[model samples]
Target chain A: MYGDQGFTIFDLQLWAEGLGITFGVFLSSSILGLIFGSIIGLIRYYNIIGIGRVLMLGSEFLKNSPVLVQLFLVYFGIPALFTIDLSPVEAAIITLSGNTAAFIAVIVISSIDAIDKKQLEAARSFALSEWQILRLIIYPQSLAFAMPMFVSLAINQLQVTSLVSVIGVVDLTRVGDIINQRTFEPFIVWPIIGVTYFVLAKLVERIGARLEQRFSVHQASSEI
Target chain B: MLDPAVMMEYMPAFWDGFIVTAEVSILSIIGSFIIGLLIALLRISENKVCRFAALFYVDIFRNIPFLVLIFFAYYGLPEVGIYIDAFWTGCFTLSIAVAAYVAETIRAGIQNIDKGIIEAAKSFGFKRVQIYTKIILPIAITSSIRPLGSVFINLILTTSILSAITLGELTSASKIIASTTFRPFEVYMFLVIFYGVLTFALSAVIAGWHKYLNRYNEA
Candidate 1:
């Protein structure tokens, strides 16, 4: 039922480019989120004077609110308020990273708490510095505990990358929008886009499962 | 640069948007719960077809983004001769999408039930339906109140996405206010805090109710 403006070979290129953008944005934001989120987690773990509480409160607001509103605040609000030019991609990265970081902080804290208090006491008796204790006794165990959560979060964050299309990011979803608009073929266009996302999510799930398995082994071996 | 004065003038608009959001959330919460319960039952049913069908539904809906699902429903529905407004479409799509999460939560609760209780019900000659309705559902639901609350809270947040189809819910309302006042930062910041507080308050209430309901177990 589509006319000459129907699907074209060029559409393949557009789809590929959209896929690249989606993956690129997802990777960068997830990495940034992990770093920042770990920092927040560490701060809370150490109980830094005043900064940890403030950061945790900020992260709570980030966690509780919708990412779309945060996107608008960073994309439209920040530029207007700060008089700085902000691109859609930049705003998306900032918002998604902050959001991911908020969740990550909680995961980190809980995983560390999962470690035994006795381990900490033993390390103290050995005259291990706080840094040494964290490095030796806490890091490996908490990481193994946190692996499954991180994997699920990674899968979640991948799906979240789709939201960038709303802000004119020309991501996969945006490409589908463009193609669907031109072709007036919602069924054909959306299913393709949806399948692409489905495959990606499944891929993440598979990879995450493998990593989870590896971490579980590491955790088991470390106990011995 | 931060202007409370502008926001105060726009409180009515925000309130109107909040009402729409509340309507969508409340309706979807009920819609999703019923649908989710059915799917949860289907997932654990003895029939292979029912089990696979329910699993497929959960997998597809959970794996895909809600935005994409809503877009499909919004645009694709009319082509097949189903005409609905943005509000109903939003509620319908949100119900189906969020129901996947709800089903999983409920299923976990169902599976976690003590096997001995089911055995006892069977020994008492309870019909399958009776066991499900009189025993299984009540226990599963009560135990899962907290997870379901988070799921519903997430449903409330997902309503903002309906704006893409022009539903004019809270997020959409704030979008309009931001453009009109030319103060997106303040508008969105207020919206963020507004949603944050709403969710926090709701979660706190859910926790209390959960504790109250499970007081017997605690004792």
Candidate 2:
């Protein structure tokens, strides 16, 4: 009986709108996360001032805690504490970005460590500046090492984006919840929502594979 | 302004929620390990149908968000006349969903076992079941203790999502307390630290156990 109410042209629009919001938030938060996380990673790598220890502790807490609690803290707690206006979407962005950044910082730090110390010393002996050494020696190798971890993290973070719906951002999962409630069709609605996420994940995997291939070409050439 | 009086009043409710979280997590860890081992065996089975079925299960469960799976089990199971309470539903869904991840990890551990060991077991006239139970499973378990522990820790964190389905777990109980006391910040911040410390402590224990298990292998 509920199936009779299901297939409308407006549903397509709703799906599109939801997909747009999901991708929009995912893309923006990922970029912001990468930038912020990389900076933190670099700071830690350089052991800058006394702030790196604090940043490390902060990020460790962020990583260890569940994202749902983080979402609640951002969505409900922050506004209550600060007496400021924050929309659900804003809270979603803030929480997801922070979550993504925490993971990214870990990835960046590990990848940087993977670079050979001997190579760095050799570059220094040749009188390369710190920026030049980083650019010429560290960036390429660390990027290669970090690519796979970044890809996996990106995929995980994409799924985590679904949690944002709980805070009332009308992302794909929230859209599915809304439609399912109205139509009472959990089976159909949730499957559609789940498949959209699966496809997005697959897309990320494919792109990451391509990048890994492209970056690993240097190793291939050297071997030949 | 800080309200010590309100937090003090809600401490009992928070403690109750913490106990429920611990109970659910412990049960689901055991449940998932058993189910995951079975699925991992099925995945490595010679029968094509069994392998395909295992793959299908893992693909579907791993791709779908845990929240959606919980919703489906919580609501759809009741529709199908399989009436169960939130705690059971939470445990069941968690076991089934997390088993996929655990299965994959175990499969990796199994595959990493040296083929020479299997050959030696076969040469010694060990039956297939004996070999699996004796040589293969033990090796996989020892090597996989660390990864499996992390997976279980993640499963514990995921149990918090069960709160959405009315499971009165830590997060849900804290939500109620926070709304009642209008101390959202303190409540959630405390919840976050609570989870962090819980997981951190579990990982430390796991690391110690892992080191102890692998001590003979170390030089």
Native contacts retained, all candidates in order: 0.82, 0.62
Error of 2 at B57 (Å): 2.0
Candidate 1 runs further than 4 Å off: A1-4, A221-224
- Per-residue alpha-carbon lDDT of candidate 2 for residues B80-136, written as tens digits (9 for 90 to 100): 789999999999999999999999999999999889999999999999999999999
Residue A22 in candidate 2, Cα distance off native in Å: 1.4
The weakest ten consecutive residues by lDDT in model 1 chain B span B210-219
Best by TM-score: 1
What is the lDDT of every predicted structure here? 0.92, 0.87
Candidate 1 DockQ vs. native: 0.86
**Scored by Cα lDDT, where does model 1 land?**
0.92
lDDT of 1 by residue, B1-219 (tens): 777677999999999999999999999999999999999999999999999999999999998988889899998999999999999999999999999999999999999999999999999999999999999999999999999999999899889888889998999999999999999999999999999999999999999999988888852
Error (Å) of candidate 1 at residue B195 is 0.3
**Superposed Cα deviation of residue A144, candidate 2 (Å):** 0.5
Candidate 2: Cα lDDT at A214: 83
Residue range with the least summed lDDT across 10 consecutive positions in model 2 chain B: B1-10
